[model samples]
Target chain A: MRKINSRQAGKKVPDYLENNIVRFVYLLRSEGVRIGNSEVIDALQALQYVSLENREKVKTALKATLVKKAADAVIFERCFSFFFTPPETRERLRELRQQKIARHEHQIKEAEQVFTFRGEKMNLSALDKTVYAYMPETEKKRLRDFLEMNESRETLQQWYRPFLETLVKGRLRFWHKQLHKEIQEVIAQRDTGDEELNAIRDAAAGSGYGGRTILTEDMQHITRKELPQAAALIRRMARLLATRISRRYRYSKKRRLPDLRATLRASVQFGGVPFKLKYKSCRIKKPRLLLLCDVSGSMIRYSSFVLQFIYSLNAVVQRIESFVFAENLERVTPYFQQGQDFERTMTAVVRESGQWGGGTSLHSALKALMMRYGDELTGNTTVIIVSDTRTIHHREAALELEKLREKVKEIIWLNTLPRQEWSSYTTVAAFQRSAAMFPCNTLADLEQVLSRKFLSA
Target chain B: MFVSLEKLQKGFTSAGYICDEEVILTVYLALRLEKPLLIEGPPGVGKTEMGKALARIFHTELIRLQCYEGLDENKALYEWNYQKQLLQIQAGRVEGRYGRVDGDLFSREYLLERPLLKAIQADRKVVLLVDEVDKSDSEFEAFLFEVLSDFQVSIPELGTIRARHIPIVVLTSNSERELSDGLKRRCVFLYLDFPGIEREIEIIKARVPQAGERLTAEIARAVHHIRQNQEIRKKPSIAETLDWARTLVSLNMDRLQGSTIERTLNILLKSRGDQRVFREQIGADALEKKIRSSLV
Candidate 1:
């Protein structure tokens, strides 16, 4: 083992040889030192000793060898202790539990867990559903046993006593989680179900109880997936529109459009000479951007960015309608909220829609959107179809696209397919009957696609 | 860090930033409150520079923690030096320094210090800048709050080390990723935006004092154009603007006209992303639109 005197008085041997500074360093890490990779490697190299039994020694070697930078040495020292630190879990829990008890110790009113037995249908409130989810199987069985032991409500009440204490603890934890959830939600439903727990000795209450919530809403709150931040791609487009500068017209208002007041003001400046005055209006458009995206497997990555682009466009795309179509078309408007957890929400979307990872039946999916939303498309519609058109087409599908081309003013097809990947003539000639095709690989291209001036009026 | 921030800003007097005393003061108040000040802005608006400047000004010390994917407390704070301790025992026999040996060698004294520790144990109030924290994994964010709540670090060996005085903590993110609520609650949030052309021109003069007035105005106008063009991947960051200004100063150019712009495009834009976007917009066509818009 390498050795060196840590104190300044002695010659400092290399760490690989036996050294107090080195051993202490490694011990700090194993016993919980913040050891960096370089330190460990250096210490091991110095000692030239290889074995798992000397884990602490290795850490010490690293501390002596690696920690040369002062700030780093301090950080390493703090980290060693932190990693090795026990965190006073007991004391923190005691304080937390006391606080929880003081806040939530009790005033129970009415909370009933509604069950949907076979063939019975009843609307479950958010509270009822949450209670059901939070109830453990053991407690549920106890409740069931209690119910089975007696037919009358009074007898049931008698049986629920012993288990009441444990349930109270969990219940306090539950609502504390809810308080942490959405302050608005907690404020929304505050006094509807609670009063002092007189009938039962120890029931759930307010402030003190805190824990990880077991309910879906609580889970959603923690994961940030409870709300949607956008309505459609239009909002995103709007955001883009807000931060963009348009091709400004030379004139404030076009002479043809006739800005009477501006002209009069200019004439007044000219002392009523009333010479020719030009005017212009801002060229920014508020077009209804109808974004139709393909959410099939081949288009997953591109689809996400397309969604983000649509989301970012805030005011640019007016009344955006987004439909993710694989084999079926699903509108995911409610899942785009600011701070929404996409992982949780998207998982739910894929599960609920059940069509995301399936197939590409774009033509039929368009048909579904058309039938349901025929009124939304005007004569001046700009249909932005974002896809590479990957299909196991029942060739009859292309006819519907042709039909769609005939209806709207313009159809812009954004191909996610790379430039080199184009082997099919369908893009160059097939859909050319009425649609404009552009190769889009990145957000920049998508921006260009959406920015084309089709209709402003 | 605010005091440090002041020093750093003074150092870069020629970059043309009119340091809003109000914004700086607000940040100073937040730091005093031990709140994490979050600065958000489009890329290149000088979000990261603020942190670097604060580190320099503090004199107490600057501890920088660059955040990225899979970052954990171990990387940010510390880990054990296993090899060193083993060797210490082996060498203990030779010099008879064995009596002085203790496990506390692996303690705080021998422990390596990271940014977080430097800030906590500063002789003077330090500045702890958790840069691009949003880029790190979200799970680790919960742990961030635990430290923020106390301004302390718990070391099993040393028991605990808390801030003797809370250091100024600033977090800068590009909003490329959303931060967790746990973290958002612990800090004061601010979003930095692009300053207007007039403000930017003034900034150029202030930050780059030697820059010619005409050159500064032209560069600022060009920067304004780049910001307007969303097609570019790398928007001209304040840093790039400084570089362009410096280049112009060195070249002895008084004004920015067409050819001068082409020569310096590489300085303003680092990659193909910026180059392509710049090419698409910064020419006669773009200028025509700019002029036309102005005329009416």
Candidate 2:
């Protein structure tokens, strides 16, 4: 007759939303809206920092970063205070939810008009800036021709850069980032005063500018702030692959690919048992990977990025020896056998990792690891290091790295910095003396190192 | 097929099954169509015994494949007779025909067939019970799909043997992890539930012939009343209802009284917590009135 209030009238609810903070964060995982600890903590921290006066804004703002996608954000908000239910209550809740959905459908129509107006302004902005981002301007001919087919304020603005647009909310940030290099190039062109414009004219052979910027946006060398390029960047890495293919093809005495002569010769012994001759050795060689990450405060941003990179690369690598280092180093190799949860795995990583935000001195850590695992790294091994070379004890640790580098076949260091930031206390720079190349400090550097330095090598 | 749902309606009325027609037909068609029927629902519903009863009505051989973790083909399918093969080799060498005779015993003919192959090759119609499949691994689930989809076996030495007729395949799952789409698409899905009080009264009277009509009805009413609660660990299945009815008959009781439920607690609930929870729900007075009302 009455609905059982298991959550208890929520006297603690606004307080739960307000005080008893349990923020439910859902990661826009591969399957669906998967709640992860990063989203949960972001929602929790957003509650603490943001005032309750703007509840809807705080929810939207928190969910924008915490939830991975717009669709997931809607689910995370609903589950944030979702109480347990008995079987009897499900039908009633189903009916009420359907009714609410019908009402929201109407609200969406009205919200859509406002949404569309904002969309038209964004289209005008994109068409004003990049000619390609705009609809083809048979526009003055038809009303629909002026706007994109999927034009809604949310869809149109973010459609320009789907990877980044979906990450933020009602406001478009990283907007300045899109036009950053372009503005700088335009300013440089103005100083050169029509010389660069002549290059565009020359490139176009005196026709109207086809309107691509003279500075080609080479996606092959895009930096790490764009996480979406991680896939494309990894594919361009040829040397890493050449090394893998070479090592994989290299045969052991015990293992060999099917020799046609060997199989045919053996077939005659069985008096032409052609059925037995069908079995043959195959070519399959996957490499074992060993990864060392620095999770000290300086490398926190790059640590997550690199771990995710290594994890995504698991389809190629046979084994990844994953380790996280701060003041001390610890192995989390087995934990990543199943793919990473990114934030949750990193949090478990940071919690048990023993030395997070502690001090760092690679000499003691690497020497300890060298004594522990010197034999593990042989001629076949490839060592990938993800860290900022700002070691706590710079000079001594640089010497330790030199000693460790002798044992491994190759060391690839991914440093998170612009080229301009690399001039200062460079432990990674010093560590590079024994490595294949000086540290790649930016995502651009990572891509360049992958393409030119490693792959092409 | 399973009475075609339209035909199942008349069959249910005649059989006094008093439940949803579609659900019964799905169970029926899964048998008739020769596809594994995966029946999922809350316990105390007759999910397990339905296969047993269907085997009875159809006069077919029922081969049960009980599943558990780490159950490999060696245990589930057929393992070679290592000792017998060794003895055959010794005996064949004495006769100087080692190669020719030992090979025949190792062929598909001499192989020990477990439930999976037994169900396929039965002389009569077979009802294969792949019970508790969720406890098995994903690899096993995939392996099962290959065999179940095609009722055939291929020995490396001998070629494949297809089933002479499509046998009845019934697969039951408790819904631990979502089954692969490959497996679900190969079968009919049916969700069975515990019967309501009125239907359960009729089931007790039908299955438990020894119990008096008044006593069976009282036991059925008490069982339904207990099933309504959510907190009980294991619901009293239809088999349990029959067990409870037979217990009263052995006690020489003409009617189910307050003391009878307490004495025969095991017949109603298999688990300890379910018995305790049921006792707490229907206190002293209701158990007394159970017999008093059924007398009418």
Write the residue-wise lDDT of candidate 1 on B5-100 in tens digits. 354446434333355543454344354444667776677777777766665545446567888766877678765443444455446646677656
By summed lDDT, the worst window of 10 consecutive residues in model 1 chain B runs over: B8-17
The TM-score of candidate 1's chain A against the true chain A comes to 0.38
Model 1 chain A scores worst on lDDT over the 10 consecutive residues at A194-203
Return the lDDT, model 2, position A441: 47
Q: Is the docking of candidate 2 incorrect, acceptable, medium or high quality?
A: incorrect
Q: After superposing candidate 2, which stretches have Cα over 4 Å from the reference?
A: A1-457, B1-20, B287-296
Cα lDDT listed for each candidate: 0.55, 0.55
Residue pairs in clash, model 2 = A15-A19, A26-A35, A27-A34, A238-A455, A239-A455
How many angstroms is residue A167 displaced in model 2 relative to the true structure, after the best TM-score fit? 21
Two-chain complex of model 2, DockQ on C-alpha atoms against the true structure = 0.02
